[model samples]
Target: MSITVNPDWWKTLFDEVYLMTDARSVCNEDITRLEVDVICELLPIRSQSKILDLCGGHGRHSLELCARGFSCCTLLDYSQVLIDYAKARAAECNLSIEAVQSDARSTGFPDESFDHVLIMGNSLGYIKGPADSQIMSEAFRLLRPGGWFLVDVTDKSAIKRDFNPEAWHEINDDTVVCRKREIKGDTIHAREMVLNKQKGLIRDQTYAIRLYGSQTLASLLEAAGFQQVTVRTGFSPHASKGNYGFMNNRMLATGRKM
Candidate 1:
């Protein structure tokens, strides 16, 4: 089937079904711990640092950080459902985390308000064109001098090496999701369909992600006024179940405000 990518698909794509479909990776505690470990190792952070989790759906990483004694952590995402879910989880767990529902491109935060900013879970490249730069600029604006900005994304090399056109997975006994992918220039256009045993076709959507090489990402970061940009590949979430999707092989692109 031919599918046209929607620029605003993400506005509704991260609902409850998304959590169910990506449960193994996004909701997995073990994998979250491992990813948090990598984040801590890659950046110089103290327990009291003020961190911003950009596009942080349901604030998984932020919650984990709070558990680890990182006191001031704020999560921002465009989805109201995810933000509310994160807030409830934080209250239930007695973890102190601030969750905000807002666009990543222009978060209404004061200048230099964060010690570090993170874009995790392969959340970048959601829209085509220069959106990445706008997000990075916001991250730059939020970070204090000497603050670090880290991005977790699928490695372009890995995707080129193992590009699968189609895949399917059983979410459970009642539901299944099928995916079809096509590469156009630097972007991967995808169509996802979710079906239930009794409900028939529940969800069908198309989205696009612009893949970036390490050098290209670094240059973008530099253009956003970040310096000392570095990229580390081979950083996998090591998820135990569900489709890895774009998280199959990941890279960390980090930069400094100064």
Candidate 2:
């Protein structure tokens, strides 16, 4: 078994089974609403505001915002599966949402095209080194003057206080997902295995993501040309069903283009 992860792990990690692995927070509509509520409070905007949901998987937050009468929202994600899922959900709910498949580092949007940009659901830090900073720079370029950029990420202190090496969760009566984690500098490398009672082994994969502390994240935003950067902690969301992983404790960082 290889402990190392593919640098392109993210390209294939968020497939259908990922919905099962992360069902508790991502699939739960109530949890999505609660999270969007916090987001709306942090960056209050008018209905006509043009918003971009970067790295928005399955458009969870975008869908919730549309249902709440926040139009003019576009969701961009690298996963085609998730983008299709988002489009289907929007159509089913009779809500208007634009779902696009694209990379966060280069969304190909016009400069200063959006009034607001968001990186919700701990979608940052997927790529190590300068990739995260490039994503932030893209966000800065996409935002208009005075536009707000908000990101949700794990709180490093909480990770230090609550790091577990190995854990398992029962996805259903016959399905289980097990995880093993190792820390490498500021990055966490994880291997996940999914097993089924009837079919036996389903999936075994390894992935890695860079973790950021509050101050470091704020500084990154500032370095990306954002002004008035602020970070608010204690944005934890409780799960009523499956595992939330690093989402157990998160911090919201906000900045302005100015």
Candidate 3:
């Protein structure tokens, strides 16, 4: 007899190998620190503000925010392995954070539970269909009145301007990853292969992310009942540089629940 696996690639893609690849990617501690600083400056955070790090893989930003004196920090992600890793790291650092394994599309938290919601690390566009809209709606629901929501994603504009079909990079001395990409009707399909000296060829996985322009994303946020939607390009801690137009490979969008 033959068995079939679930079609949800995200379920399997976030395993150990995925974590290793991510560690080598833009998801390192230094980047997390810079992102946290930018978030702190943009949002009206207080000592008692409840912050939800939505889709926060491994609680990097959550832990950093907690260390910076934001006490009530909750890190939520769909991957149990990542949640466990975040919990271990939080314990090791003697920091207290609520780490929950939950889907970003429909988080079970109560309405208006958070004072601020952060969706970072190009995590917004992963879901296949109207699910992205649902994610935005859920973020709107989770925030209190006047709460802030921040989202960071790859700049579709820049990607279109300079499309690279294939790229390879060394994550470490012993491991390298190659990515082949193709854009098909608003979705960027990607195939990734990880090569390791000891393990040989680790694995190959394919995934798709729906691309969005600044106006499209801002409209989505507005449709979800967000106000003061601001879209910016590039990642910078400085407000002036961060709010500039789409000139870099990454983009950021922030809104307020009013």
What lDDT does the true structure give each of the candidates? 0.90, 0.89, 0.81
Residue runs of model 2 more than 4 Å from their true location after superposition: 239-243
User: What's the true lDDT of residue 34 in model 3?
Assistant: 80
Off by over 4 Å in 1: 239-243
Candidate numbers, best lDDT first, in rank order: 1, 2, 3
Q: Point out the worst 10-residue segment of candidate 1 by lDDT.
A: 235-244
Which whole-number lDDT from 0 to 100 does residue 174 have in model 1? 94
lDDT of 1 by residue, 1-258 (tens): 666977988889999989987887899899899999999998998989999999999999999999999989999999999999999999999999999999999999999999999999899888766888999999999999999999999998888778888988888999999999988888888999999999999989889888988888889899999999999888777744334778768889999998
Tens digits of lDDT, candidate 3, 1-258:
122223487777886787677663335666678878888878999989999999988888999999988999999999999899989999999999999999998889999999999988778666666888999999999999999999887778777767777777677899988877788877777788999999899978887777888889899899999999999875543234221122135778899999
Error of 1 at 253 (Å): 1.0
User: Using alpha carbons, what is the TM-score of model 3?
Assistant: 0.90
**Clash list (residue pairs), candidate 1:** none
Best by lDDT: 1
